[model samples]
Target: MPFNWNWAFTWEILPKLLHAALNTLLAAGLGYAIAVVLGLILALAQRTPSRAVTFVIREFVEFIRSTPLILQIFFVYYVGPQFGLRLGPWTAGMIAIGLHYSAYLSEVYRGGLQAVPKGQWEACTALNLSPAKTYWRIIIPQAIPSALAGMGNYLVGIFKDTPMLSVIGVAELMHTANAIGSSSYRYLEPYTLVGIIFLAISLPTAALIRIFEGYVRRKLGLK
Candidate 1:
C-alpha cells in the first residue's frame, strides 16, 4: 500500500492528547512535590541519632523501594476501600507514584547528606549549632548541589513514567491514546503521536536539567 497521512484525524485527536497531557503533567508535578518533601523526611529519619529509628526508616524505605510500583498502585487502589479509604484513579495514582519515587529520592538525598565533609559537621558542632541549625544552615547548603541533579533526574523520570498511571485508569496520555485508538481503530497515529509528544516535552526538560545542574555545580564549586 502507498503511504497515507490522515491530517484531519490527527488534528481531531490532538485536543484529547493535550487534555490528557495536562493530567499527566499535573500528576507528575504533585507526585514529585510529595516525593521531594517526604524523601527529605526519610533522609532525616535515617540520620537520626537513635539506632532504632534509623533501622525502622531503612526497613520502610527498602520495602517500598523493592516492591514494584504497579503492584503498589493496585494494592492502594483495590485494598484501600477495604480499610474505609476510597481513592479516585488520579488520587491513587498520584499517591502510588509519590510514595514509590520517594523511596528512590530518599537514597538520593541520603547520598547527598553523606557527601558533606566530616569537617563540616564538626565545624557545626564546634560552633555549638543546634542539630536543626547544623543541617539547615550548613550541611544542607552543600548537600543540595549533590542532590539537585539526582532530584532533577527523578522529576524527568517520573514524568516519563506517567504512562504507567494509565493502567490504573488515570486518564493520562497513554490512556487517551488508547481511547482514541479503540474508538477509531487507528493505533498508528495516536500511539505515534503520544511518543512524539512525550519526547517533545521530556527531552527538552532533561536538557534543561543538565544545563541547570552544570550551572549549580560550578556555582557551588562542586568537584
Candidate 2:
C-alpha cells in the first residue's frame, strides 16, 4: 500500500480548522493586548528610582522568561484552584500566554527605551516637563519606532504559540486537528493542513511586520 493525499477530505476538514483558527486569533489578540500594557508597566517600573521595586520586577520578568510557557499554563489552569482562583481553560490559557509574553516584550521595550538618547531626557528635564508628559508626549513616541519591529515579531510569536492552548483543550486549530485525526484515524491530512495553515498565516505576518516597522520609522522621522 502507498500513501495518497485526499483533496476531498482536506476540504472537508478545512472549515473546522478555519473555525478553530479564529479561536487561535482571538487568544493571540487578547493575550497580546495584555502583554503590551503589562510589558510597558514592567519596563517603566524597572526605570523608577525605587531599587527594591526594580529588583523585584526585574527578577519577576526573569522568572517568567526563564520558564517554559506550557508549565505556566498548566500551573495557572491546574494549580490555581488550590488558591481558590478557579479559571476556565480559555481564561487560564490567556493569562499564562499574556504573562509569558509580557516578560519578553518588557525586554523589547527596555531596549527601545534605552535606545532613546540621553539628550532627549535632558531636554525634557530642561523644559521641566512632568514625568507623565515626558513619557507620553516625548519618550514613548520616540521609543515606538525602535520598538515596533520587536513588537511585531512578538505578535506573530503569540499567534504561533496559540496552538499550546490546545493542550488545555481550548479548541484552537491544533486541538481541532487532533480531534479530527483521532476520530477519523486519518492523521496525515489533518496534520498537513495544520502546517499549511500556520505557514499561511505566519509568513505573511512577518512580511507585514517589516512593512509596518518601516512605516513607523518614517512616521516618527527616524528614517
Candidate 3:
C-alpha cells in the first residue's frame, strides 16, 4: 500500500486540536489541585488516633484505588442524574478525575509520612511539642521533600489520563481527534498529532517536576 502524508491536513487540524488541548490541561490542573488537598485529608484521617475511624478511612481509600477510573466516570456521569445531581461534561470529568486520583495521592502522602524516622517523632515529643505544632512545624516540613517526586509524577499521570475524559463526552484533545478522524475519514494525522501534543506537554512538565524534586532534595540536605 502506498502511504500519503498531508501537511495541509495537519496544519488545518492543529489549531482545533490545540484548543481542545487547553481544556484537557484545565481539567488536569483543577483535578490535581483537588486531589492533592483531598488526599491529604484522607491521609491525615488514616493517621488519626481512633482505630475505627482510621480503618474506615483506609478502606474507603482502598476501594477507590482498586477500582477502574472509567467505571467511576460512568457512574458519575450517568448515575448522577438519577439522584437529581447533574453536571456538565467538564464538571463531571473534573470531579471523576479528582476523586479517582485522590485515592492514589493519599497513598503517596502516607508513604511520605512513613519515611520520616521514628527518631524525629521522638525528638518532637521530647521537645514537648503539641501534636499539631509538631506536625505543622517539623513533620510536614520533612515530609514535603519526600512527597515532591511522587506528587510531581502524579501531575503528569493526571495529564496523560485526561484523554479518558473523552469517554464521557468531554471535548478534550482526544475527543477532538476522534471528531476529526470521523469527519475526515483519516486517522493518521489527527491521532499522530494527539500523541505529539501529549508528548510536548508531558515531557516539559516532567522535566520541571524533576528540577523541583532536585531543588527539594538539596533544600532538605538529602543529597
Candidate 4:
C-alpha cells in the first residue's frame, strides 16, 4: 500500500515483460514496413493528373489523420468481419496500425518527394525517360536523403504507439504489464517497469535514428 518497490516481484515478472516486448517490437517493425510502402503509394496517388482521384485521396488521407487510432483499430477489428474480413487480433491490429501511420507517413513522403527540384523532373522529361524509370533512378534517390529524418521519427513513433495494439488483444508489453499488475494486485512496479522499459528502448532508438540519419546523409553525399 505504501510507496515501496519490490525487487523480487520485479525480477519475477521481468522475463514475461521482456518476452512481450518482443511482440511490441515485431508489431512496430511490421507496421512501419507496411506504412512505408502504403504511405508512398498514397503520396503518389495524390500527385496523379486526375483531379477526381487526387481530391478523393486527399480527403481520405485527411480523414485518417484526423481520426483516432483506437477508432481505426476498432473499425478494422470489429467492423471488418461484416465485410468478409474475419482476421485475427494480430492481423487486424497490424493492419490498423499500418493504415493509421500510413496517413501521417504519406504526408512526410510527400514533403520529401516535393523537395526534389522541378529541374530534376524536367531533366527526366528532357531525356524522354519513362515515369517509372525517372522515379526509380533519379527522383527517388534524391528524395531519400530528405525523407530519412522524417521516416526515422515515424519508426520510433510507431514503436511507442504499439501499446494501442493491446486493445485488440495483442500480447505486447503494455498488455503484459497490465496482466501482471492485475494478477498480482500490484500496480506500482509493473507500471514503473513499463515506463522504464519504454524509456530504455525509446531513447536508444531515437539516438540510433539520428545516427542513421547522419549515415544516410553522408551516404547520399548530402552532407
Candidate 5:
C-alpha cells in the first residue's frame, strides 16, 4: 500500500503518547538525579587514600561502563527477583539507567576534579581546612564548570536511552508508540510522532543547557 498520513489517527493517539511522555520524563529525571549523586561518590571514592578501595571502585565503574544498558535492565528486573529483590518495572528501569549513566558521569566528574589546580589543594591545606570542607566548599564549586558540559550531555543522553526501558515494559513513550502501532496497525504515524516529540523536547533542552552553563560560569565568576 502507498504511504498515507492519517490526521484522524494521529490526533486520536496524540494524548496517549503525550501521557506516556511524562513517564519518559520521569524515568530520565529520576535516573539522572540518582546518577548525579552516585557518580560523584564513585569519583570521590577513587580519590580516597586507600588503594584497595580506589582500585575496587575504579574496576566497578569500568565494568558498568563496559556493559550494555539493556543487559543491566534485564538483570535488575529479572535476576534481582532471584536474589529476593522484586521491583516493579519503573523502579528496576530507574536503577538500571541510573547505574549505567553513573559510570559515564563519574568519568566526567573525575576529569573535573582533576582540572582543579594543585595550588588550590595546597591552599586548602595551608589554611588548615578539613578534607570534607575543602572538597565541599572549594573543589566541587570549581569543578562544576568543567563537569557541567558533560553532565548536560548525559542528561540528554539518559533521556534518549529511556526508550530502552520499553523492552522491560516501562510504559515510556516508545512503549506506548509500539502499543498504539500494534493495535491500530499504523506504524508510520506513531513512530513519526515519537521522533517529533523527542526532537521537540531535545532541541530546546540542548539550547537551554548551553544557556544554563553560561549562567553557571558567570555566577561562579569563572566567565
Candidate 6:
C-alpha cells in the first residue's frame, strides 16, 4: 500500500509531542549549563601549576570524549547503583550529558583561551594585576569573542543529543515519539513531527548564535 500523510493524527499527537519537547529543552538547557561551567573549570585546571592535576584532568577529558555518550548514560543510570551512587533517570541523564559534552567544550575553551595574545599576559604582569584580575579583566574578555561561536555551536549540539537521554527513559521528545509510534503502530507521523520540531529549533538557534557572536565581537571592539 502507498503511504499517506495524516494531518489529523499529526495534530492530535502534536500536543503530546510539544509537552515532551519541553522536557527535551529542560534536559538540554540544564545539561548545557553544567557543561559550560564544568568545561571552563576543566580548561582552567589544565593551566594550573600542578602537573599532576593537569595530567589527571587532561586524561579524564580525553576518556569522556573518547567514549560513547550512550554508554556513559547507561553506566551512570545503571552501574552507578551498584556502587551505591543511585540517582534518578533524569539526574543521571543530565550528569552524563553534561560530563560528556564538557569534555568537548573544554577543548573549545582551551583554544579560545590560548588564542588570547601572550602580550596581554605580559602587559597584565607589568601592571601588577593579580592572576584573577588578569583573567577577568583582560584575558577572558578577549577570549570570549573567540569562544562564543564554538560555545554556541555546542549549545545546539547538546540540544540535538538530548535524544540520547531517552535510552534511560527520561521521557524527552524521542522517547515520547517512540511511545506514540508504538501505540498507534504508525511511525511516520510521530517521527516526521520529531524531525520537524528539531529542525524548527536548531535552525533558529544557529542563526541567533551567529547574531549573538557578532554582537559580542562588536561590544568587545573585536570587530
Estimate the TM-score for candidate 3: 0.94
How badly does each model clash, as a count of residue pairs? 0, 0, 0, 0, 0, 0
Give Cα-based local distance difference scores for all models. Answer: 0.91, 0.93, 0.91, 0.92, 0.96, 0.94
All candidates: CA RMSD (Å): 1.8, 1.2, 1.7, 1.1, 1.0, 1.3
Quote the positional error of residue 97 for candidate 5 in Å.
0.3
Looking at candidate 2, what is the lDDT of residue 206?
96
Best by lDDT: 5
Candidate 3 lowest-lDDT run of ten:
1-10
Better of 1 and 6 by lDDT: 6
User: How well is each residue in 79-168 modelled by candidate 6, as lDDT tens digits?
Assistant: 888988889999999999999999999999999999999999999999999999998899987888898989999999999999999989
Worst 10 residues of 4 by lDDT: 1-10
Q: Could you tell me which residue pairs clash in candidate 2?
A: none
**Candidate 5 off by > 4 Å:** none
- Candidate 1 deviant stretches above 4 angstroms: 1-4
> Candidate 6: where are CA atoms >4 Å away?
none
lDDT of 1 by residue, 128-215 (tens): 9999999999998898998998999999999988898988899999999998888888888888899999999999999999999999
Q: Give the TM-scores of the predictions, in the order they appear.
A: 0.95, 0.97, 0.94, 0.97, 0.97, 0.96
Candidate 2 residue 93 Cα shift, in angstroms, is 0.5
